[model samples]
Target: MKTLLTITLTSLLTFNIAFAQTPEERGLEIAIESDKRDTGFADQLAEMLMTLRNAAGKESIRKVRVKTLEVSGDGDKSISIFDQPRDVKGTALLSYTHSTKPDDQWLFLPALKRVKRIASRNKSGPFMGSEFSFEDITSFEVDKYTYKYLRDEEVEGKATFVIEQFPTYQASGYTRRIVWVDQEIYQPLKVEFFDRKNSLLKTLTFHDYQQYLDQYWRADRQEMVNHQSKKSTTLLFNNYQFKTGLTDRDFDQNSLKRAR
Candidate 1:
């Protein structure tokens, strides 16, 4: 009888141990799992300043500075100013990207005294001679892609959740992207982009993260390298502000022509 009692007690103890994890703990685990599959590089924001540069050649460096303003459910508008290689001072490139349509791009050639619309198909072309394709300039949102959690590992001593995101946008050149996100910060650290043919195309890295307003995190710099072309583009971000009181009127089609 004592042996029987001991066995029953042991079973009860085992059952208790199995059920020790509460609903909250289980929910947290599920949330982390879901987060791995859904999180994007950045959340929605109002305005950002970016500087873009081409990979250095043997003799010179080429670069440009840009300011981007984004409005949810409308689109993004940007003003790009050429900065390097001396001959093109004061030249500006302006673009308004559409979520469901082809982007409208214009270039203000100070020397030509006109604002010329960039040809439509050229949307896939290089931007200002940089390795970055024009589509790269658009702000990335979570809705543009569908994600799946691939695995979990450690990066730079911090645990990371690895995920794969497939672009749903028709204009995107990439078929899929694999990202490594830090578990603690929920920020993507590395991304591998695959072309439409499923070939490895480019790798993107994010660094120098800073938290904003105690609620958001932003990466100060992003670098993208074309594996086949041996070229790269680096973007440095500055003066990021969120919830800047921007209105729907700011993102209207009429505003594109007047965007500074």
Candidate 2:
């Protein structure tokens, strides 16, 4: 029997006839709606503890602070500063994400006392020896993917819309992603990543979501597990503050080097 969501998509396609929307269009509609629901945060800041576990189950931890500014008509700008792990201490990464064009990124290395520009081509590489690639950590923009509705399913007892999203640009380590989005919140509950060769690579799960400003939802914890490598990274977010009046100046390359 077709579920309600499936029936709805089918009806949308059926009604349009010649101008019928494909599963892709219906999927994109869901994505756009999800994106719309999360808008208007203005800005936010959070502190995180990242735990990286190797195949042997040994773990190393790093402390970091993150700042993000929502863009008016495009993707957000963000800066992540590493405060722990003495060797990488005081290091920061600045990123300006665009919905349709290649993202711009720069890394501040205190050891070198200079900022290094990260080429778009290298965005697929591992970040700080963790399972997450630089591409995996960017702010999500709807235009970044071409989506197709997969099915309606339940994840961890929560009703979800399963959709397949294909990367619409280059330098992405993942060729595609299957996402399980919570029906009520419009936020993703889980995501399975496929490598460049379309092989299953990693799965990310979100937990302990709390809403802020009575509208925005932020997860307290996120875990990403690498299937082939048997490695994992867990990020615990704390002290989330929203609408803090952050601006573009706070995310610039120069500010990255000056981040304390």
Candidate 3:
């Protein structure tokens, strides 16, 4: 009888420990697990078509080529080069994202033959006239935000854990973001961004996710809608090639000018 009593007490203690976990702890655990599953993709290359729609329903399209290099112990490095539309052609944006520091971004304007650095204060502004801001384009790192688990709910037929995350970096445009992470795949299905005023600013949704190398999941389509401006931007991604032998040199400032 004593042995059985001790067993029961141990079980109860274990259950209580798990049930006592704070929301913040659970949120961080989820984020860590999601990040762990996506690790080890050396590099990636893809073609993208960006469509911008204004409140008046006016639409504009741009073609772009994207290259990314995974950085161990830090955030990834990425470079985007405009391909089509003669006016924006040869324009490139290079970014060096860090886990806990202000990200470095630069735009190379071929027409002006100069590289303009993106100031930290202006990171909140729109990127290339799109609804997505400069702060939105950077690679997501776990340490960049403090998280709190909100609740679990179904999002578009998938069970997801809704968590709220506040950016830890300086000069961020958003006060907080609520993300719906798919429970099965450990990837985000939807995100709602709140502005510095703590008002709902934008909603971003991912669609048609395809897995690469049986590990990484890539969203084929992403839509970002600005609630205040009534404008939206849709990114259609295609021709995804992973582990493309990309290197640090490919993401450097010099490579931005040479991108073709």
For model 3, how does the per-residue alpha-carbon lDDT over 48-119 read when each residue is reduced to its tens digit?
Answer: 898999999999998988898999889889998998777889999888888778778888999888989977
Best by lDDT: 3
Put the candidates in TM-score order, highest first.
3, 2, 1
Point out the higher-scoring one by TM-score: 1 or 2. Answer: 2
- Candidate 1 lDDT tens digits, 1-260: 99999999999999997688654344345345544443332223333223344345322355565555654554566666665656865676766776556777777776666778876556457666665677666755555566666678887777887777776667577888887877777777888988889999989888888887675667888888888877677767666666555554554444434444
Runs of candidate 1 with Cα error greater than 4 angstroms are 1-60, 121-123, 239-260
List clashing residue pairs in candidate 2.
Answer: none
Residue-level lDDT tens digits of model 2 in 122-239: 6678877888887777777898899998899998899999999998877778889999999999999999999988999999999999999999988999999999999999989999
Best candidate per TM-score, number?
3
TM-score of each: 0.67, 0.90, 0.93
In order, what lDDT does every prediction score?
0.65, 0.88, 0.90
**Model 3 spans with C-alpha error above 4 angstroms:** 1-13
RMSD of 3: 2.0
Candidate 3 local Cα displacement, residue 53, angstroms: 0.4
